[model samples]
Target: MSTPTTAPATDAASAETTAQAHGVELTEVAATKVRTLLEQEGRDDLRLRIAVQPGGCSGLIYQLYFDERELDGDAVRDFTGVEVVVDKMSAPYLDGATIDFADTIEKQGFTIDNPNAGSSCACGDSFS
Candidate 1:
């Protein structure tokens, strides 16, 4: 049998446009929470960076952190005063995704509702 081939990578501009079309959104609640967290840390130069990484029980994991570095091909969106950044590779996977904050008795943290996820693990931490 012949070896399978993979598609070539997209250019930065095209990738960004595609990502925008996919609809990655940060909810007002999430933005407010992020802003509060930054204020508590006395930081104003950080942006919330979200990305998908390989690993976890489901083969893919979501990574969320505050980053000051601006890498090439990073897709950024500003919700009021808060900024959210997603790397190019993770952009496609995060399309039509929403980031929200939950502050109920049962759950209290940031949550990601990703439409691109085909399957996820029990804890809802990873997806494939």
Candidate 2:
């Protein structure tokens, strides 16, 4: 017999309310890589922005990219050596979220673990 798995809390509105509502942590390795990138760019004004966009099989997708601009209504937080900025609109969808980096071949990249998502699609794209 197989045991059933229960989902995370169905509501994460508070955590998703603002950029500072919850904290996101970065691994030492990931932070170091970000630091190196900034040093190489010779620009400290850039930030690592994480956003949730509509698409993917799960009806939403995670977007990780570098941004130098802060638009109206943005949640910004400093994670050790890197500044993580998530737009206001994307906050609720990504509340209680953590951005992590893995060096292993199986998961060698930046990944977002969002508590707000009820379920992620089969391909790890989009979420309910």
Candidate 3:
């Protein structure tokens, strides 16, 4: 697994408080999709969480899911009643990034366009 770029946490408490602030953009298309999914699940308390994890062909991979619990150092924003959260460690990598959904005969899913990523792998699942 590729290590996070942030400094090592001295302790659990410190780790929880050490997240740097950053903004991640969620397009209307993406927010609508998230809201629809949450409605289908009958969950009004869940928020969409996006994170960068280690694994995949590239050093880092993207993790997206619905989370009801908000961890320490989590950054959150609301778009059209849809809440999106990003962990402290993953904030830097996703800053200024945009998430969009594409629905077509060939492609149907959420996609991330991160300006911070220098390059991505052939599978389009990981990035540096």
Alpha-carbon TM-score of each model against the true structure: 0.83, 0.75, 0.82
Q: Given candidate 3, what's the lDDT at residue 26? A: 93
lDDT of 2 by residue, 27-110 (tens): 667777788878998989899888888888878898888899877778777778688887878877877777777778676777
Ranking by TM-score: 1, 3, 2
Worst 10 residues of 3 by lDDT: 13-22
Q: Against the unseen true structure, what C-alpha lDDT does each candidate score?
A: 0.88, 0.76, 0.87
TM-score of 2: 0.75
Clashes of each: 0, 1, 0
Residues 1-128, candidate 3, lDDT per residue (tens digit)? Answer: 99778755567556544433457999999998998898899989998999999988889999999999888789878788988899989999999999999999988999999999998998788999
**Cα lDDT of model 2 overall?**
0.76
Candidate 1 has its poorest 10 consecutive residues by lDDT at 15-24
Error in Å for residue 108 of model 1 = 1.0
lDDT by residue for model 1 (33-62), tens: 999999999999999999999999999999
The candidate with the higher TM-score, 2 or 3, is 3
Better of 2 and 3 by lDDT: 3
After TM-score superposition, what is the CA distance of residue 109 in candidate 1 from its true location, in Å?
Answer: 0.6
